[model samples]
Structures are given as structure tokens and as C-alpha cells.
Target chain A: MDVIRPGSLQDCLRILKTEHTIPIAGGTDLMVNLALNKISPDRIIDITGLQELKEISLSDNFLKIGALVTFSRLAGKEIAQYPCCNALREAAEKMGSPQIRNRATIGGNLVTGSSAGDGSVAILALDAQVELTGLDGIRKVPLSLFYSGYHQTAIHSDELLTAVYIPIRPGTSSFQKVGKRNALAIAVASLAIYSYIRDSHFEQIYIAIGSVAPTPIRAVKTDLFLQGQKITSGVIKEAARIIQDEIAPITDIRGTADYRRKLIANLLADQLQQLSESKN
Target chain B: MLSCKINGEEIHSEIPSDMRLIDFLREEMNLTGVKEGCSEGECGACTVLFNGDPVNSCIMLAIQAEGAEITTIEGIAKDGKLSDLQQAFIDHGAVQCGFCTPGMILAAQALLDKNPHPAEAEIRHAISGNLCRCTGYQAIVDAILAVSQRK
Candidate 1:
């Protein structure tokens, strides 16, 4: 394998397009696939050393995460202020093991484009955006529109994912996921719900579920049912039904489609109840 | 070819681009304390502190170590004396077959260095990356907690 360590972002892009290389950051996902002969590339550009792609900063409305920021760094003091993605922080804390989380990256997670990837679901639920850089220039795309299908993303072969932008929610948000075990386990089904409560009712709601569809999906139908509705067990039951109907999960080694549906229903009910019980 | 500081020593070597950090440490540097249990990064037998953060050495390539500081179990003890964490592990019977001992100690060291007074849950999370089939992990957690409290 040919390895190139470029000093600058421009140099990195130049090498990427000229050598037709696959970029390596963290290598938590890419290395495994490469070792298993899933992908064979002539050159690998190591961007884990690039300082520009290792940042997580916040602005008035957005939280910008660098591509090379590992899950360890993401779960550190820097991003802890936004409790809106608590489930994401918990998921990151639970992903792989401490070692894997220390090395695996948020950008690599998105670029890998696995349906069961933990960070991808929360990013989608928070309505994150992807920043891509290539020979043409830089552009940001909504993460919801980033994935085209299973193990697929809109990232061009020549483009490198530089950052993920998540909008800060004005109100409370929660995330819930059920896996085989509490540690180093992939989710059977994960749910992230964000909503606004005013006058003791859910005024607005946004729901996203993972590992139960071709990609991380926003439960638009379920959200529609919950919006403007009081936070009640009866309403939660109805919303859970809509979520079960909206998701199209497939049978896999981890779990069956039927189990995923049931898990989603239960997770939705649980998260809604928790949100209702919260002081905020 | 890769160049980096390993265990307080600056070194350069010509290695295959795809060679893992664990292989580099064990085969090239002859630091056998870093073990390779699961090449898929599941087990932390190959755990190492890269730039002060604990990471699975098996999945990281040797080339990724360019210009980085790496600490393996070989570096845990300084000047022929075992680190406090290692002594605590020994006193607490955290070692069964001793295969996971190095990784566990290095992982715990990384944790303590970051947060000297980690709680029980934090200690568990710190070593969660390391897998030991021998001792059921209670002794390991106890050893780490004991060392942290002593500090």
C-alpha cells in the first residue's frame, strides 16, 4: 500500500485526486474493511495528522465538528454543553470500546455510511450537515440527504468530508438505543427525539430512528402525530404505531425486522415518557 | 517508512504501509508487551496510548504513528520500577493468565492521567475497551480504583 501524509488540506486534496487514494482517519471502520479485502486501493492518504480537520467549534446556531475528531474527543468537555444530543453522547460513549471510541471518528462514521452506525443516527436526528471539500471547492449538504442507500453516501470519491454541522435545538432533546449488550454492541434499534414543550404540552417534535431502515430516517408521520398533541400515554401509543408503520427494517443477524419494529415502538414510548417527566 | 517517538525513544523505520501499530511495536521494536488478541479491534490486548489517548493498536497503521507519541505496556514502568497502577493490579490479583494485564494497565494509566479521581463507573468505562476472559474484570476495576484513591 502507498501511504502519503500531506501537510495541508490543499495538498491532501491534490494527493486524493491525483493518486486515487482512500483517506484514512482513525481507521476504526476503514482498516477493518480493508483487512477483510472489502476494499482495495492503490494509495491511502493519512489525514489523521491534519490539524484542520480535528476541530469541534460552536457558533450562534451551529456546532461544527471536524472530520478527524474521534468519539473520545466528541464526548469530552468540548461538546458537553449541548444536552440536546445526550443519547448521541451516550451512544458515542458505548460505541465499540473505549479504545475504539478513542480512535474511531465522527467523520469516518458518516463516511462509512453504515445504517447501524451510532453517530449517524443522532446527527440525522439533530439535522446535521456534511461539509465536503474537493477539487471544485467546499460545499455543505444536509446529512438527511447525504445517504443515497445502504453502505452508500453522497460523498464523491474525490471529495473528503471535512466537518459535520448540527443545529442547536431551542428546547430539550433525548436519544435512546437498545443493543445486545451495554458495551461494544451495535444497536438493534435507536431513537432520537427532539421537541419543544410549552404550556405543559409538546408544541413541536422531531423524531429519528436508526438500524430499522435503509438509512437513519426521520419519523415524519410519527412526528406529525405527536406535534400539537399533549404528552400522554395514549398519544405516545398512537405515535408508536405510526413509527412502527413508517420504518421498513430488514431481517439481519443482529435482529429481525419484527423485533426492530417492536423496539422502535417501545423506545419511542420510553423517550416520550422521559421527556414528559423532565423538569425542562 | 514511518518516524515517531515510542516509549520516550525517537525512531524511524522502513515498514509496510499497511502494517499495524501493534505489529510494529511487537515485531520491529521487540516490545512484546503489546499483544494482538483480536485483529478486529474488539479486544484491547493491543491497547496503546497514542498522543495521550488510549486506542486499539491493532486497527491503527504504523504509518499513522508518524510524528506521534506512543506509549505501550513496555513504557508503563519507568526506570525498572513498576508504575503505581501496575503494583495495584498485582496487589488486587487483577492478573490471571496475565495476557490482558499489559493492556489493562495501559488503559487504566490513560484513564488516571486524564482524570486522576475517576469514579467506579468511570473506571469501568476506562477499561471497557480491554477484554479479559480470565478474571471477570472485578479485580481489574478494584485495582484501578485503589490506585486512583491512593493518588
Candidate 2:
């Protein structure tokens, strides 16, 4: 395979538009595919050279993270300072390993569309939007609506995921994942919650789940149920019940369908319990 | 052609840039110290320093390192003297079959370069990527901690 290191974003877009070349960043997932003979491309465009997509900036309380920003940066101390970044940062910390995090990119994670991907699920809970840049122009897609099916995304072959925009809101967020082991294990199930809790009641809440569906999904019913509800053990249990039915987990090597459903409920309860206890 | 620095030496190669960084450093440049136990990234046997950060060289393209500095196992010793890390690995019995020693040392080196004095947990977390089939991680962690303690 031939590799083209595009000097500019526009140049990369032009090549992607004109040729059947595949765009690669980090190459963590793509390399695995290559090793397994899953994808054999004639030409590959290394978009890592596009420096514009490697920055993280905040303006007007909205954080724009470049697509090439590795997980190491997202989970690093610098990003942990952002109040709205807690969930994303937590997810980055739980992802793969130090070596894998050093190379994996948020853009690559979204495009790979693993239901259990740390970055995607965490960003989903934060109600983030992905920026897709193509030869025509750039358009934003709500991360919730980005995935079409298992291992599939809305990104066109000619388009590249340039950046992710996260709305910075004042709240506490947390992410949890159940894997075989603490490090270097794919998630059996994971959950992330972002909320503004006052007097043990949720003012606003967003919940997202992964590894239980074909795509990482927003826990809409559970979120709506928990919103404005008093944070008690009873309410937490009810929300857990609501989420078990809302998610569509499968029996995979990582976990059984029943086990995943059980995990979601427990994860939700554990996170909500923390908030309730903190109020005491 | 790709121009870059490997093990403190400036070099250029016209070989296909699509080759894995591990293959480029080993087959093309003869830097076999960058092991390739698992072509996939699951095993840390192919870890190397990419611009000072440890990464799975097996998963990276040689073209990706066109202008970046790379450090492999060969880069650890300077002027034929064993780096402190290498000496610690030996003193602590961190080596067994030795297949994982190179990757382990490089991964530990990257961690030390970033945080010279790492806690035991930090040392374990840093080397979590590099797995020694010998399952002698306690010694490896001890060796890394010893080096950190010495400094």
C-alpha cells in the first residue's frame, strides 16, 4: 500500500475526494484490521500531519478538541482541569493502555464505532457534536446520531472527522466501565453520566451507555426519569430498572446479554448513589 | 523517501512507507531490538518511543515517523555503558526468557523520562502495556522502582 502524508487539510480532502485512498490517524484500529486482513487499501492518507486538527481550545464555554488529539492528552492533567471534561477524561483514563492511549485518536475512535469505545460513550454523555470536514465544507453531527449501525458511522468516504465540539456546562460528570481487568481490557459495559444536582435533586441530567448496543446510546428514558427526581436509593433503583430495558445488549465474548443488562443497572446505581451520599 | 532520527542517528529510507514502524526499524534499519512478538497491538512486545511517548510500533506506519525522533531498545545504552534502567533490570532479576526485556526497558525508560520518580502504582501503570510472558512483573516493577528510588 502507498502512503501519502498530506501537507494540508485541503490537500488531504482533495486526495480523499479524487482517489479511493483511506484516511488514517493513529492507526490503532486500522492496524488491527490490517493484521486480521479486514481492510486492504491501495493508498492510505496519513492525516496526522494536519496540525490544525491536533489542538484543544475553549471559547465561549465550548471546548473544541482536534481529531488527532490522543487519549493521553484527553486523560492528562491539563484536560482534567475542565469541569465539563470529567467524563471524557475518565473514559480516556480507562481506555486501552498507556501505549495504546498514546497513539489512539478521538477521531479514529468515533470512526471505528466500537460500541464500547471510551471516548465516544463519554462524549455522548456530555452531549457533544462531531465536526466532519469534506471537500464541500464542514458540517456538525450530534454524536448520538453519528452511528448508523454496528461498526458503522455517518462519515462519508470523502469526508474526515476533523474535530469534536463539546459544550462546557457547569456540572459533575463520571464514567465507569466493566472490563475483564483494570488495564488493557475491552469494556463489557460502560456508562457515563453528566448532571447538575442540587439539594439531592437533579436539575439536569444526561446518561449514555456503551457495549450493550450496536451503537453507543443515550439512556433517554432513564435520563428523563432521573431529571428532577430526588436522588434516593429508591429513585436510583428505579432508574436502573428503566435503563436495563432501554439498552439492547448482546451475548458476546466480553459478556452475556443478561450480564450486560445487570452491569448497566449496577453502574447507574453506583454513580447515582455517589451523588446521593455526597449530599449527606 | 522518509528522513528521521533513529537511536540518535539520522537516516533516510526509500522503502515503502506503508510498512509497520516495527518492521521498518527492524528489517530495513536492522534495529531488531524493537521486537514484534504480536503483529497486533494486543501485546506490548513491540513498544517503542515515538517522539518520547511509548507507542505500539507494530500498529504505526513508518511514514508516520517521517520527521519524528524514535527511540528503540538499541538507544538505551550510551557509549557502550548500560543505562541505569538496564542495570536495575539485571540487578532486580527482571529478565527471564529475555523476549520482553527490550520492550519492557523501553517502556520503563519512557515512563522514567516523563516522571523520574514514579510511585509503585505509577510504575505498574506505566509498564502495564508491556507484558512479560514470564509473568515476572513484580521484579520488573521492583526494578523500575529501584531505579526511581536510586535517583
lDDT of each: 0.86, 0.90
List residue ranges in candidate 1 displaced over 4 A: none
TM-score of chain A of 1: 0.96
Fnat, 2 decimals, each candidate = 0.80, 0.86
How does residue B45 of candidate 1 score in lDDT? 91
RMSD score of candidate 2 (Å): 1.1
Model 2 lDDT at residue B55: 91
lDDT of 2 by residue, A1-280 (tens): 8889988999999999865689999999998898888998888999998899999998988899999999999998767887767999999998999999999999999999999998899999999999999988999999989999999999999999999999988788899999998888989999999998776689999999999989899999999999899987789889999999988788978889999999999999999998787677
RMSD of each: 1.6, 1.1
> How many clashing pairs in candidate 1?
0
Best by DockQ: 2
Worst 10 residues of 2 chain A by lDDT: A76-85
